[model samples]
Target: MRPDDLHRYITERMRMSHVYQPVMLRELLKSDGEATVEQIAKALLSHDRSQVEYYEIRTKNMVGKVLTNNGVAAPVKDGNRIVGYRLTGFGDVDAEVRDRLIAECEEKIADYIERRGGNIWQHRFNAKGYVPGSVRYAVFKRAKYRCELCGASAEDVALHVDHIIPRNRGGQDDLSNFQALCITCNTNKRDQDDADFRGVADSYGHREAGCIFCEVPADRVIAENELCYAIRDGFPVTPLHTLVIPKRHVSDYFDLFQPELNAIRRMLDELRSSIQDEEPNVSGFNVGVNAGASAGQTIFHCHLHLIPRRDGDVPNPRGGVRGVIPAKQSY
Candidate 1:
């Protein structure tokens, strides 16, 4: 791409596009041919590199993509751990083009401030970085220092910084998009926020066990695992009523294996925020399991209910699950 086109892609799309990779590339080349992604990101974004701190996965991804696309930087992977990248080839940034790119970023920032109304200039102006430290702390706290995926506390597992909506899914690295995950779950969810969700509906079309859960398309699935999946309840009792069902066609919840139960529980926690994003008024929940025909188990397939509770779905909110038995619902 032309130098001007590359600069436009970075400034116009950096917040939203993986195409900004080349902008990050220029900074990597400016380093003695190689540097940490953060190093490259900071050099590209800030006037003073010391003020540069851990900002967004957005930056690292752009840098990595640029390097990977150009076939110039090779990652130093230690088993599951990716240590860093080393520059192997040089399709570098010349001084003239580099100056031109910086100038373009400044102009865009000024234009953005004029169009929108925010003192976001701290960000708009070659922001040392877009995300501030305050936001990161808030994201961690909002997740209650727990793995937002498996509900494991930081004490139980190492914590992680993650994007609730991944970049591959066209998500920005903004505060609302941030989330916390334990190391293991984060590793499983890595890079999946985008492509995997899109492919889910079509990937297992042949696994039809003749039941709704088994044959249901992947798009209907809110979350899933190797053994089972979760979906919005077809006929919702509440706004975000959901069902977690095993891929197996077993009729009773008692028949669910330990792993399937574990997968359902994990997905329940992960899907909560996603539900609330659609309907913010959710105040509580009603989790239920109806076992047999006498208990009004109509579907015959084992499915766990994840019904969201609102302030007043009915006139009387008394007796909770006992309401299923009517007269027994009282005393």
Candidate 2:
């Protein structure tokens, strides 16, 4: 195409879902109509405000606080946000002295990188080096484009495909091994991969022969995590009713562990998303747990009911879970 054709296409015919097309074109133009994929990607990364926001949080909460407390530097705040840092006594230095100081900083960075080697970036890159884009999309989809760790939406922050178990600790590159985590949660969890979870793993093995949920067949399980499995209710109150049960035979909901609770919540969210996709009319859900005999618990094993609700499913759906009592359902 000639210059006029290119100009016409850019100004008139360019349809943009994001800023990517123009950014890539600008990069190519800057590089004399050619640029490596890496160069273009780096150029794109420069425009990602979320990444800068992620580092801003790190500066304010972690490194900046440390420096400020040590009397080495202070935070430059733009309202409540830490926009940058100002070094102590640095403003007093001339251009030459500042250059020497910058060189000293560079030397320190180089020495640290040399000493640590690739281990410095071990938190970001695992044994496999990178997760396939398809696998990442699947993980993100399963998590409903929200961080599984902190429940942050993808629009609110940058999400990462993180290993539930770190690769250094023998985590696999399987679909089931990956989870969607926001940048903040991922960074907070990075160095804490060494936390011992052997006892938690062992707890999932606790089961009683008589408990129906404890012995739920593999065939019945629709979705599961390490601590919980979800199955379609045998006698459903609604069409897409689900039972999210803990692996361990814990009779009381109060007796369930935190990890087990997290697993159950994740399974519930996954099932809800599936139901919504499969049944477009699904407007809401009813989550219930019958604790003891008085609360109408039939099985000894703890199981949560996830019942999908639709418009006009009931004559009047004013008080949802309160409908269990029937009398107080109206008010």
Candidate 3:
């Protein structure tokens, strides 16, 4: 066949295979000279049977015959049975054919992205790394060595400087973006990827100039003077829950100093007391804070959740932020 005809046939066959275009092209180039259909399939599909079947049909149609070594088709030996086929010297030539196929595929992909009005790099942002010492010092100063959420003092409490808006969401490596979080709250909101809650720190002036928390008729809030702010727990395993937040907006427990930590502790005490008085049958509490989306902090503003727990809350409350969170594990 003419090289142009072979290229076109190879391209059409590859399109029908449903293999990942870029990955297949890379494998073809990487082989340097030759590769088996079995080797190619193993590289592409790994253990996926659907993928193997798709490639098998495509390869047969394109190449006219199964690849072989010494007149025997390469086959996966499962006990005494031949389960799969391998490629031959002819298959190596086919790899070159696949390369031309990929160029066409890339053009199609580029056209698709252009039609959709998507910039290739529009999603990427500046990812400036943080200075650890500065971050630690900033946390200590922000919280005044207190737990911002629970108001635990630094004397016995562990503190962390948490990002109010997580780093993943274009949060800058600056002091204002950090908050003092306690061990409990820090563990809760660790590396959270949620963008809605963790709005860009610089974009706050543009987006949240109006406070969504309270209905005060003010353009800007001088202070959010309440100890415990109410927030929703999106993936609640428990029913009837709310979070407590400090009046001041801070990210983590470590961001709070002595006074702020004291305030948080006082708030928790009051909440616990109130719950005991109002709901006498209240069995326990599932208090938490998420630092980042990965850790499960959905909101950027500093807050503590007071989740009411009853018997049989969940079969396994051992997953999510609760399971692997590195808090005071005893509590």
Candidate 4:
């Protein structure tokens, strides 16, 4: 299917479900008609250098999935080199895509009002230090006429002044509470609290394109013990594919202590029990882990996949995890 067709399907499905990759690849492309993973990361992460690579890899992967032409979406290559990413047919965006973004905007507006309305109006609505003209301009100048989120410029994109503390979080309309953010980032920050607004922008809600394996959001969490937690996969190969993760942010599977391992194991059982109780059609299972980069680990965080499988989900399921190695799958 064309990218436009895919977008229509996505927008319709999103009404009843929560999806993370609601952005189209073309929406993020620069005027040069392509964007590197790192460039795209800055657009999403803004100035957060602490977790660039984690968001970068996921953005790179999402390019292949969401940006398609004739049902094929992959990176644009220049003879054994990946130059960047792009999507085809860019006159006017599909109405579905536009509607999806609008819906996202509306949801965020409501969330912001619900969370910050009373407190912000009480303090900064008509309060004295509500900086607007010259002072707000200084914040933009300090950020170099660029969006503090998404890295958009005054040339290509309009910017907005955002409260770092936010109205609900004791933020006033004064200079101290303000920062320069693109409208996209400001809207995406709606579902997030003050502390996590920037951190989880690319991992949760509609605009996300980050390493969900390592950066699982609290909302996706299903069950947890003292040491381990179970989170539903953001992009699951199968329904109810859940990950049992260690609470302490260790990367390697072997790095997990016995207590962490035991906690994960127990959570696995709890997840399986709940799946059996809830989804009776789910049959069989695929339990596995990807250890390192070469071993297929994408996020660098130790996570165990407990994927539920049904009888006829695939044409053949003899090889199971050995499907990871297509050449040696027969035996």
Candidate 5:
């Protein structure tokens, strides 16, 4: 379009969902009517004050704390807001010395980036790499544009779509496997919680060659996720009874990790819905786990029973699982 048309559209007719249209156009205009996606993205990022606020918090709480503790620099705060930082001894030094120190700092940053390469940003990109914009929008929408972990509004803090079970720990890319967290909460969870997922990913592959659950045939798996699977019980306690099992060979439920529990829970909910759909008479479910042989756990490998309960399945079902102990079934 001509300049008059473009200007008219921008001034009068441009309907905006966000600042993106103007920002992208500005970038393209600055580059002679052409700009890379990266350039547009960087320009858009400059308008994101939430990300800037996140880094400001990091500067004040982490880097500033360290520098101040070591007597190297201090924060320049406007009331409670930290606007910038000042080097401790730089003001007293000669101009040449100050320039030399600044150069040294630049050299340190360059050397670290050269040594670490892109690994320095691994935490941001994570093992799953870039999440598509649509998927990120879905996650944020699911969270109602709030942090799932801390309930921080998207307007107040930068929110991230995080894996409920980290991909490095064998977490999958299922919609059920993601959560929304604000920048502050996400950083604390990843850094301060000792997120040492080094061997956890590989550990999900552990299996005993002879274990029934571990060696369960592919045909038997009715449903599966990254860390667990479900199958029809060979010996059904109820018509549509099922077994939710961890892929890893662990002795019992007590040995399962948080991610394993999450996977199992997802499988249980899915199977429950499927069973109810298939069997209209199914009134409820009995979820049980026998942890040891003494507790009637003969399989050894960790598995949970998802028994579909129908009305009148038994003469006295009021006691439910209390039937585990015959005498205690009454109350």
Candidate 6:
């Protein structure tokens, strides 16, 4: 039979009878903690009481048979009553079964919701006035079909029109604060908070240069080209990392203009290229701009990190900027 036919047959068989009771029992063990025979029987009662009893007896008999066949010692006993059964070593069958049942439950719930005029996709936070087709097309054109983060141009990989500053934290809904990001980078930035520019300045031993990005000397001057800046004497993860600033700082990526955006991009490309020339075997790079404190952006000045990643770098290089600081310390 064809694979689809086999799949259909198996599904039909599963739905027909209490054959899947053992699988359910395993799932119960994993989720509801250790189960007594009574608990197991109660679960199987949903199928059929007679079937449940049969399976319970079958299960115990099968276990005993397996133990005897494997030449394992019999289960312990307390004066003619079997105390407990323990297997040698371990197996995670219960976990596997539980995951399958949970997935089935989720699918059923999703189907029920769909039937009731509720959309599963509707729960996702869609930006107001964003047409998915237009946004996707614009991002593709703007980034030239390449990942704005890594410069990868594979069409199979869907690109994201990401907000440089997240909308939840007062970021304006505009194209200037948008960027074309790859799946990896986009996933990484989710829920990240904008970096605190004031705190960063304090850390870097620089007086609040009054909106350093736009050269606004003191007073929160709301102006275009407002950038944030940061200094890294010795960057924790990457060496010699310094971030450029934009003064009239907006937290979203869609709020940047051509001139300011071009300048930052050029600087990063030049930096990466120069580093590659210096170190022949530099495998990859990590360029990040945190729009919020949660995302690990310490300075609010629209600053971007040019981190050079090499082979045998730090173990498990996940968490991007957050990985730089100890868990207890705030960035």
lDDT of each: 0.63, 0.78, 0.54, 0.62, 0.79, 0.55
Candidate 1 lDDT by residue in tens digits, 184-215: 56655664444553343233233445666667
Worst window of 10 by summed lDDT in candidate 3: 322-331
Candidate 5: which pairs clash?
none
Model 2 C-alpha RMSD to native: 6.8
TM-score of 6: 0.30
Question: Tens digits of per-residue lDDT for model 3 on 1-331?
Answer: 5657657656775565444664565576689645677767667766454344444544443333434424535555589855566644334456667888688989998898888764554422222334488667856875689877788787755565666656666655555456776655664454333446444333333323443442323433222322333343444444445445554555565565333454565556566776677677778886766676567654555566666666655544556334222232111
lDDT of 5 at 170: 66
Better of 2 and 3 by lDDT: 2
True-structure RMSD, every candidate? 16.8, 6.8, 22.0, 26.1, 5.8, 20.4
Ten contiguous residues minimizing lDDT sum, candidate 1:
322-331
Q: Is candidate 1 or candidate 5 better by lDDT?
A: 5
Model 1 reaches what TM-score against the true structure?
0.35
Model 3 misplaced stretches (Cα beyond 4 Å): 1-211, 214-239, 317-331
Identify the leading candidate in terms of TM-score: 2
Off by over 4 Å in 4: 1-215, 315-318, 321-331
Estimated TM-score for each candidate: 0.35, 0.65, 0.30, 0.33, 0.64, 0.30
User: Residue-pair clashes per candidate, as listed?
Assistant: 1, 0, 40, 1, 0, 38
True-structure lDDT of candidate 5: 0.79
Instruction: Summarize candidate 6's per-residue lDDT along 1-331 as a digit string, tens digits.
Output: 5657645666664454444555554655566645777766566656554344444444445666577579663665689866566655445569888699789989998888878763544523354526367756765776898778788664545466776655544443444456777665565455244575344333323334544443443443211232233344234465544444444454445565543574456456556776788787787776666666676655455556666667767665474433343222112
Worst 10 residues of 5 by lDDT: 322-331
